[model samples]
Target: MKPLDEQQAAARSWFESLRDRICAAFEGIEREAGSDAGFAYTPWDRVDPSGEPGGGGVRGVMKGKVFEKVGVNVSTVGGTFEGEFAKSIHGAGDDPRFFATGISLVAHMANPHVPAVHMNTRFLCTTKRWFGGGADLNPPIPYDTDTADFHVTMQAACDAHDPAHYPRFKQWADDYFYIPHRQVHRGVGGIFYDHLSDDWARDFAFTRDVGEAFLRIYPALVRRRMGQAFDDADRARQLEWRGRYAEFNLVYDRGTLFGLKTGGNIDAILMSLPPLATWS
Candidate 1:
């Protein structure tokens, strides 16, 4: 790939920094629970179709008393999108060359009461450059207070940028996260936005705020519910719910598809899958 431009470099730097801070925070939670669990990082390189050196990323995963399974990954890659896949991406239909950098995370807690969560934010450049991503909460056993708090925090981030952002992106998330075959919503909705190519500084600021909001609200929610008591029945339900999450990611998640199309590391791409899950 070619050298990154100013905006691309900045976005990549911020994403790696966010990853470090988040890993530290999660390790702190483990210590609070008297477990020494910490993230294990693995780096992988990407090869484009032309056998050129595309950028790579590190995948960090942790399994502990508090977090049953969690994966945080940051990757920056550039290459020529192959065949018809290029047509679907924004600004890539004609040129087919693209660059992207982002951070993605998914956490599944040991306690059923503590919600599972997913968050991702990315910047992509083709003929056009833009930002996209969001966070959503998925609790096997739902709680109103937790749901409300999550939405409120995300809304504050959106409102800081544009008042219209929250409702619009919230609806986008609601729609995007649905499992059409199952006819059920994946989880309590958050915000999802894409193709935000208006003002570089403004969009970048908003994207960073989204990451900050996730870092702020999710760990608190984890602490709130991670100590609650759960029975075998609750564990069963959590497992069943994880089945749905798996289905959505495997069948409907655009990020998953993007990773496959772009020659991303298979293990890193599939890290979002729960450690355990059961259908029905």
Candidate 2:
């Protein structure tokens, strides 16, 4: 078990704040759609005995709602790391001083018209240095307008900090979210960057402020489309898209890869999966 650095502490606080806002926003969405939506948060024990070394975030589930088949989770899991993917991505130095912490989130929406979304942010530190986390989206459906709006919201957040950020990072999302074998992107893409070296402090401040942007943008998008109504055909397409989502995560997502490599608890890592998934 190890103690958190200043950046990790800030990231943890941001993740917690996002967790609360996410729960409330979706609850309101379900209500507005005239559907029942509720979530349960289960706190899990940290991996290390000291409790400071690691811990799981809130796990939530919502079912039989007007616009969601199952809204299974929104969470932040933080801890130190090791193993193949972590070593490959974050580097494996002999120094035990390096510590990693991050938050990951995913939501499954009911309406075929709406897209599923995910966001993650974190900070990793060694005695001498640290870096930041950026977020991205994976929508199930391909609504051009919705996709544009989603990216635009993300871009706006980045633009406020640095104009150059929106384009480069958006392109990063576009590239990062793709399923290479399938030859299709996960969604329109938001933004994904990690271990940033340039303007690290600016990136952190930007990351923290963007949390509010997420709280504002995502629910508005969901509310607009969740109850818009879709036919059986649309529902089928949604399922098909979700199948791809599952494949990408199970097959290629970096987070999933690291979790498995670290001997992380299976349930916590797979908690990102939708409860009532369908494949065709």
Candidate 3:
């Protein structure tokens, strides 16, 4: 693996900082809900089969009155991709060496009305370097207002970079996040993008704005709906929808596949799974 350079170091620092800010925001919400729950971090390391230091990261999780369960993971791993996997990854064909740094989050709300969400942004250094990630909202009972607010914030982030970003990425999210077995869209999608290349500076700036947009909007959405009342029916719907979420992540989510393939921590890789979900 190539020695970590200044760019990789800078990206890794930003990811960790984002993780801290997000965890603090969530802990604050927990406090507001009268629960003392705060994120408990567990650090893990990865070693190549050759026993070389591959890199490592920390997993942060919190369970509380408002956030039933949430996981924020930051990992920077470097190693050669295994035999067949090298053919599939960017920049690994010539030499299987690679490095990746990113922040991933999954929040499952206790209140059904407060939609569950997923967000992740990453920079991967293979023979190629690029940025990828976006956020999506999964509501048991969809609300026009909430969906609109989420998309509007996402659009502003895209518009800040390029006029074409929102429309392109919005369609990309709808297409990428679809569940073929169930033949349904995963959620009222936000945006999902990947393989964004052409310029590192511009792409990195856009990726940072994407995270900023999520931080700015998601908590406000949580505060608005967390207080809303929900009955048994709503709870059941949330569970059933969560089943769909689990199926999609296990079957189709690229991030899940990437994590598992890269020898990432199993718990952190599967952290997107809701604590409790129903098939029916």
Candidate 4:
């Protein structure tokens, strides 16, 4: 298969792997929470009516009754990266070709106690250029222990790839996951970068390793915490905090900006938005 085709296949396979991993992770979380948190899985596929040739996301969501306060959503989108990609992203110079092949993944956690997470890996291309996707995290509620634990796990994964990677990538995540005007942070921020120019072996290794680490670490974290039993007041407070998170994504998140700019399908782009969300 050609490089693009190969990348496409890899992305598809990765999506399935991610979905399965997250499902298992949440299942463990539900067990720990001592409740059967049901999952909402939607495999959506649609062709653009605008004659654009691609659309929609295959998505999965989970919410436990015991942990009814917590949930996780995962999805993948394959379509033309036109208006949305062009307008919303930064650090990428003006170029129409960045929309060449559209494939991206984003995952969100509903519990404020469990950090709300975001990861996106895509295959971007132009007539003369190409690069694989990258992943990052955005946690709305920052707990030093969880935040530190999260970064520590990721750092270990990156360190296994390159010792220097942890500090730099962790800083990158901090910088990338931010709402500049608010002067607060989007969670504590985790490693984020675009079009890194480095040895492919090392970069690919780091990305792949981090992916595995996510599978290894997050599910257990969620299982341990999700259904621990928060009061309605706690859930209410979480929803209030989620409202802030929603504002950042809708108003300032680069991904949301890019998705909207590229003329992405509204539903697909907005899938990143929680089904029901509020702000304080």
* Candidate 2 off by > 4 Å: 48-53, 64-86, 96-98, 127-132, 276-279
**Residue 71 accuracy (lDDT) in model 1:** 98
Decreasing TM-score order of the candidates = 1, 3, 2, 4
For model 4 the TM-score comes to 0.76
TM-score winner, 3 or 4: 3
Better of 2 and 3 by TM-score: 3
lDDT, residue 231, model 1: 99
Measured on C-alpha atoms, candidate 3 has an lDDT of 0.92
> What count of clashes does model 1 give?
0
| Candidate 1: residue pairs that collide | none
Q: Candidate 1 residues 1-280, lDDT tens each?
A: 8999899999999999999999999999999999999999999999999899999999999999999999999999999999999999999999999999999999999999999999999999999999999999999999999999999999999999999999999999999999999999999989999999999999999999999999999999999998899999999999999999999999999999999999999999999999999987
- lDDT: the better of candidates 1 and 2: 1
| RMSD in Å for all candidates | 0.5, 3.1, 1.0, 4.2
Q: Candidate 2's error at 130, in angstroms?
A: 4.1
For candidate 2, list the clashing residue pairs, or say none: 67-110, 68-110, 69-110
Error of 1 at 51 (Å): 1.3
Q: Regarding TM-score, does 1 or 2 come out ahead? A: 1
> Mind giving the per-residue lDDT tens digits that candidate 2 earns over 208-257?
76666777777787777776778888877777787788888898887777
lDDT of 4 by residue, 124-195 (tens): 444333333444554444566766777778788877867887787777767766677777666666666556
Q: Residue 2 of model 4: what lDDT? A: 22
